[model samples]
Target: MSLRCLIVDDSARFLEAARTLLERDGVPVVGVASSGAEALSRAAELVPDVVLVDLDLDGESGLDVAAELARCVSSVIILISTHSLEDFQELVAASPARGFVHKSALSARAIRGVLGENGTGSAP
Candidate 1:
């Protein structure tokens, strides 16, 4: 089954880029939110299979959203951020996130790997 995805980023350009990339790779992006508050609301409404979140949001941090998602939904939260791997690792270790992804190198393959998908090449 295709993995239902949600993108939470404050930048419109970044959001569009991510949406295009994921959709091209066959991942269904069900919802997009520009802020942590919006993410929280939409996440509950959509309950996507995976949530791709930006570390720096407009009003709140993605880490906060990750924690909230853990309590509010069953979706796996993957943090996509511009932060360095070391910083991302520290944040991920503290938060209840499934993984950390560098926005600069985000790809369908990498996403699939994080999700533990096999060689099917099909969306999880």
Candidate 2:
């Protein structure tokens, strides 16, 4: 079955890029949000299989959203961010998110791998 996904990012360009990539790979993007609050509200409605969230949201932190999402839904949370691991260690320690993805290195194949798709890898 095709995986359902939700993307939460503040950047319009990044959201568009991620949407294009997921659509091309046959993953259905159920929703998109520009902030943590929006993502939280949408998650309850969308009930996606996976949630790709940006750590730095417009108002609140995405880590906060991920933690709340874990409780609200069964979706696997994967944080996408430009921050270093060291910078986000506290948030990572507090959340139940499944993985962390760097925005600078994000690609369709890598995203596919995160979604448990076969034949996709971290390297492009």
What lDDT does candidate 1 reach at residue 43? 94
lDDT of 2 at 120: 38
CA shift of 26, model 1, Å? 0.5
Which portions of model 2 show Cα errors greater than 4 Å?
A: 115-124
**What is the lDDT of every predicted structure here?**
0.85, 0.81
For residue 36, what is the lDDT in candidate 2?
72
Q: Please count the clashing residue pairs in each candidate, in the order shown.
A: 1, 0
Off by over 4 Å in 1: 119-124
- Candidate 2, residues 40-75, lDDT tens digits: the string is 899989888889889888878788888888888888
Which window of 10 residues has the lowest lDDT sum in candidate 1?
115-124
Deviation from native of the Cα of residue 91 in model 2, angstroms: 3.3
**Native RMSD of candidate 2 (Å):** 2.9
